[model samples]
Target chain A: MTRTTYARAIGTALATAMRDDERVFVLGEDVSAGGPFTITRGLVDEFGKDRVRDTPISEAAICGIAIGAAQSGLRPVLEIMYIDFLTLALDQLANMAAKAHFMSGGQLSVPLVLRTQGGAGQRAGAQHSQSLESWLCHVPGLKVVMPSRAVDAAGLLASAIADPNPVVMVENKTLYFRSEEVPDTVEPVPLGQAAVLRTGRDVTVVALSGLVPEALHAADALAADGIEVTVIDPRTLVPLDLDTIVASVRRTGRLVIAHEAVRDGGIGAEIAAATGRAAFDHLDAPIERVAAPFEPIAVSPVAEDAYLPRAPQIRDAVLRTLGRELNREGCRLPRPTA
Target chain B: MTLDTGHQITMYRQMVRIREFEERVKRTFTDHPGVIRGHTHLADGAEASIVGSIAAMRPGDQAIATYRCHGYPIALGSDTSALMAEIYGRVGGICGGYGGSMHLADIARGFLGTSAIVAQNIPQGAGAAYAAQLRGRGDVVLTFFGDGATKQGAFHESLNVAALWRLPVVFIMENNSFSVTVRTEEEDANAAAGEPLATKAKAYSMPGTTIDGGDPLVVQQTVADAVARARAGDGPTLIESLVYRLSAHGNSIAPPGVPLHYPEHEAVAIYGAVEEYEAAKRGDPVPRFRARLIESGVLTGDQAGAIVDEAQAEMQAAVDFALNSPLPEPAAALNHVYA
Candidate 1:
């Protein structure tokens, strides 16, 4: 096993893709100097300026170039600097990238990956830190990938580069420094596939991005209460690993979906709606959605913590679905007096 | 470079076809309201502006234009029947009826696509150029927009990126002096009415030129020079074609059923009567070019007249084909949503 951080894994994956395919290139602001988060460091040195091009401060052009390059026999991985600035490029991303292939009667293919960072733990203010994955996930043509682990970052990006359609990789800003034991030779993890982090029969906890590890922690805590919650990390949200999630929910009869995006119109809502219809007959109780409240990520640490969802929220949600004791936040009570 | 007489005639015929097609589509809407859906923007007086610039490009070069895009595809050699079917919302359309007049795209001809939003194509065009540069290909991209697009952030962003990277891109701005009903005066208080829109290209370290859009031959030469500079890896160029839109901004920009109030020359003239206004329609690109072709001996009067008649017949056949084409199956919508 090789230990690596999410940022390094991303850099390695980019290097690997560039080395393997001459058609694959990287572009963004300060990307040659690595990136704002240092995920693209060392790429320019190895690939030279031609492959690892640094673009001007134009999100629309960055994304538009990716789309054009993808359509014209190139795989371009572009960075937007921050997820909030994605607003400026939504016309190109949503209207142009999303609709080009379909509207062209399948004559064109946009094999592009839009890489951007989003999360709210570092006090980077509202504009810098925002979990806006739900907006892209809502679009029809776009594939939204949220990697929670270092290994998945490398694996998913490799697959995204090779994917025949447009994919948006939303990297959690806080998880950039997080390290884990990844394979020495990282293998590509196919998109629309979910990984079962923990095996439990009592309940199913489906989470994404940074919340996956939190859900696993919650599952460990619930084990003390004789409640085993199945934790499933759906790496990609678009062609969602619904089969794995629904199968797990059918086995457990209760479900809890967690995400960092706001509760309203969040991706968790879509999972809840899908699972409700698919596993309706087997569901023992209503689906519980554990996500941040409908508010922007605040600068204050305390307010941000309260506004975000984590392990405690997942544990409480699982217990409540199981008809266990109630506690503060009106959720289920904690493990008895351990 | 001087275009051969055959090439000039071809360009002229294509321009006539574009005008005839738009006029035919407008008649379809008037003669049959249900033929087209929603509002439509027609490129009537801007034929030379669109056709001349496209003539400067190689067949493989990518071209993107604005919402007034009907003329560009025809100028780029897109199938007229498919374009007509597309506007009529039929399965046989270029985009299979999914993209109407506002979103006509023919990738086969290197026409990337058109965006309804003003100046949205600027950044996208820059991207196409960037990709070509990355691949070490000499291909270039021509992005056509309006002076109104100059106010859009995408326009400036595209220029900055194209200049910084020295990408092969030609930014063409058709300064028609109006953004819908709002005149250029109200739209841009910064620039004078007759100011050259091309000078804005200097901020990005690229050559900018303003030319008379009424003459196709001049437009062809100027854009050919810009496209040459781009293909030579020297960088991007901004070409502002001073033109006009003889038709309503959209089908309903003017009064409910009015064709056009008057041409800009007659509208501003003190003694500009309706007859003079009608006479100024002679300045429209089709007739003006027809006269030029005759005077230049590139084609005789009989030959030019024959070409116009041929284009009108072709347009009528396209309308017939569009009306006859079937509606796409409902399930087709779910097919390409992913790939």
Candidate 2:
């Protein structure tokens, strides 16, 4: 096993994929200069200008070109420096890649991967740190994958590149520097499969993207109180593992879904609804959700922290589902490692 | 005019088919209550531009056109019924009823697709041609847009890129003298075309020409030269085909004259006065080609009418098939968002 930062893991995956397939190429603004975060550092030197293309500041044109290239059998990995910038390319992402196959009656496929960074925590402000996974999840043909750990981020990205459809593999801007032990072996994690980090019987906690670590911490804290909690990380949002989530809820009879996206239309709502509908008979308590409030994320660190759901929120939701109360000490559970 | 006669006639028939089809679509929109609720633009007068360029391509060649794409796809070999069903929003339509008249895309026939977004297809068409060149497929692409499209940034950018890379693509400017109510002359053609649309091709270091688009055969000759040049690895070409739209910008908008450049009465007399029967008959390139075929002794009028009738019947069957096709499964709508 090689221990590496999330950024390094992404670079390694790109390097490995490019080495294996000549058709693989990278394009985006500032990509040739090692990317906005230096995630693609030294790639241009090795892959040459043809493979590592630096495009103009036209995000839509970049994505549209990638779609055209992918349709023509080129495996293009487009980097949208930030998730907020994806709004500019929404037409290509939503109208072109998302609907191409369906409109073509399955005769054509767009095997393109868009690797973008999202999530708040770096105090990068509203525009730089939004988690708009829900917006992508609304589109039917696109696959939305956000890995919780360095290992899955690397593995899932490889699988996404191999997919015959368009894949939006969003990495957390906060997680780029977050290091973890990644397996040296090249593994392609199957999309739509949820990873159970911790198993408990009292509540089934489903978290996505960068929130899984915080969820694990909440589960660990709840475990000490004799309240068993199972933490499920949905690696992919579009091809959601509703079956696993529902089954876990059925077994536990309680659910608390957490995410960094806005609460109203977030992936958590969908999961909660699916769990409620599928395992309603097994519920011992109502489902609880911890998510960002419905509003434009503010740039202030204080406001951003308040905007994102923390571990304490997750822990509180778990205890609430278990019918437990922390009194005044509930505010001082433990700071999240995120 | 030898072996190409069959192909040329095929191309001519394609034009006739589109003219007829667009005429029928206009009639359908007018007669069928609650069919198309908005302004509908019929390519009533632009038959030559569509047929001429389409006839210039070989198998595996690609085409990307504006919303006025009826003739391009017919030339590219899309089924008439598929097009009819598309206008009808039928389930089995080319885009599964998702794309109506403005959003037709028949991938199998190499009709890359059409977008309602004006001038949006320019860069996309260039990209497709780039892909074809990169793949070494020897396939050239023909992209068409209206006089209005030439004013878009995408048009200029795509032309620059296509020229820079010497990509196998042809950019056809359908100078139909109007963009809705706006006339080409009113928009300052000198500034827009930059010394005639054909000379603008020279800026990209490629050959360009303006053709008489009133004659589909002449248009075909010009387009064929460009297509052949592209296939021979000579790079991109810019073709300015000067044709008349013949109708109001669409069903809702009045003719070009009402807005300014030309007289409204003349615009109507020329474009709107196209008899419903002639609009439907020569509406498609096939009817005009059939007349030519009879004059040339290649076939009798009866034979050509039979072909047109058969084409209509085939289209009717496709419309029925599409209309009867099942609606998409509710859950199927959730599929394909990511891939």
Candidate 3:
């Protein structure tokens, strides 16, 4: 095993895919120059400018070109600099890329991967930090995967590049620099599989993307209090690993879904509704959700910290599912009836 | 760029086939009411431009078009019966009823399908050219769209990239006078300023030319020159072929209860310009080319009559086959959602 950051792991995955297959190439704005976060650093030198292409700031054309290239027999990995900017290319992504295979009646397959980052930690303001995975998950032919760990970043990316359909890999900008020990040769982690980071009997806490680390940390803190919280990370949002989540909910009989996106129509709502139906008889308490309020992510660090859902909010959510509350000074108290 | 007698006869035959096929599609609304659902756009007056542009392509070359897509696939040698079935949304469709008139694709014939959205296929055509460039093959791609598509950002961005990378693609914009009901001059800056739409290519540093779309020989020569330049790795060229659309934008869009039919030409219906529509009818490319071929001794009068007879029989067979084909199974919709 070797220690690496999330950014390096993704870069390694791109290099490995390129080395394994001559058809694979990378294109985006400043991708050859390593992009804004340097996630694609050192690729141009290895693959040359022909393979590691830098394009104009035209998201719609970039996506359409990628789709066309994929249809013509190249596996293009397009990087949209920010998930928020993806809105500019939604017509191509949602209409063209997502519908090509189906619209062609199986005569064509778009083996393309669109990589972009989202999450609110750096004060990048509203435009750069929005998590729009829910928008992609709503599409029929798209597969949306978010890798929270360095190891999964390499593994899921390999699988996504190998898959025959269009896959949107939404990385977290906040996790780019976080370091972890990943295996020297990371295996392909198949999509639609959830990882149970922590197993406990008290409650099942399902966290996504950047919130996985926060949930694990919350699990550790709750373990100290003998709560024994169970934390699960759903690596992919589209073909959700509902079986594992439902099994955990059945055993624990309490659930909390957390993410960095707004709760109005976040992925957490889908999971909650699906799990609520699948494990309705097994539930012992109401399901809780820990997510951002319905508003734009703030630019101020202080307000942003309050805006983001973190370990404290997750811990409170877990506590709320157990009919309890955590007051100031970190003390557990009896339930407060409304 | 010069076409021999046999090649000219073949071009005439292809143009006749497209014209006959479109006439049948237009007739289907009244004869076999509701056999075709949704919107169906026709390439009636643009037949010569479509046939001429496709005639420039070689074996490995590919083409992508807008929703007015039937003419290219027909010229590319896709089965006419399957094309008709696709328009009829039958199980025997080229796309197995998955794609209707706007989405016919025959990849084996190098017809890479089309986009229903305006100007969206421009960048995709550049992308296919990018792939052809990477393969080190001299193959080129032809992108077909209407004059209205120039107003979209996709058009400008794709042109800039295709020129910048020297991608092997040719942009063929059939200037059919109107976007839908709105005339081109009302929306386009160049048209409003009394300039050809091909002038837009000047901003991208690529060669742009304008030609009469009604003459098959002119379109074939112009597109052939552009194709040769793209194959030599010189970059993309934009050619604006001016023609007049003889049919409405599409079959009248009505609810299920209201029967769909082809309305009058937009000029006569919207602007009351009966003279303009009549003038375009007088210069209809199919018969114009047929008369030219016969007069030039490239095709005898009897040979031209035989070609028209064959095209009518072929399209009649297509219509019959589509009428006999069954509707696709509802469960089949679940297929092709993933791979």
Best by DockQ: 3
Tens digits of lDDT, candidate 3, A174-287: 999987999888999998888888899999999999999989988887777778888899998878999999999999999999999999988899999999999999999998
Winning candidate number (TM-score): 3
Which prediction has the highest lDDT against the true structure?
3
Is candidate 1 or 2 superior in DockQ?
1
Give the per-residue Cα lDDT of candidate 3 at A127: 96
Q: Rank the candidates by DockQ, best first.
A: 3, 1, 2
Query: After TM-score superposition, what is the CA distance of residue A106 in candidate 1 from its true location, in Å?
Result: 1.8
Model 1: docking quality category: medium
Better of 1 and 2 by lDDT: 1
Better of 1 and 3 by TM-score: 3
- In angstroms, how far off is A51's CA in candidate 1? 1.3
What docking tier does model 3 reach? high
Q: What are the per-residue Cα lDDT tens digits for candidate 1 across B1-339?
A: 788889889888988998899889888866766677666888888998888998888866999888889999898888899999998889999999887888888888898888887887788788788778876668899989998999988888889888888889999999887776566766774466556778788889899998999888899999999999999999999998988777657764454444422223423443345564464476788788888888999999999989989999899889989999998888878987978
Off by over 4 Å in 2: A224-226, A326-338, B1-11, B26-41, B89-100, B150-166, B181-211, B221-238, B247-339
What is the lDDT of every predicted structure here? 0.85, 0.76, 0.92
- What value of lDDT does candidate 1 attain over all alpha carbons? 0.85
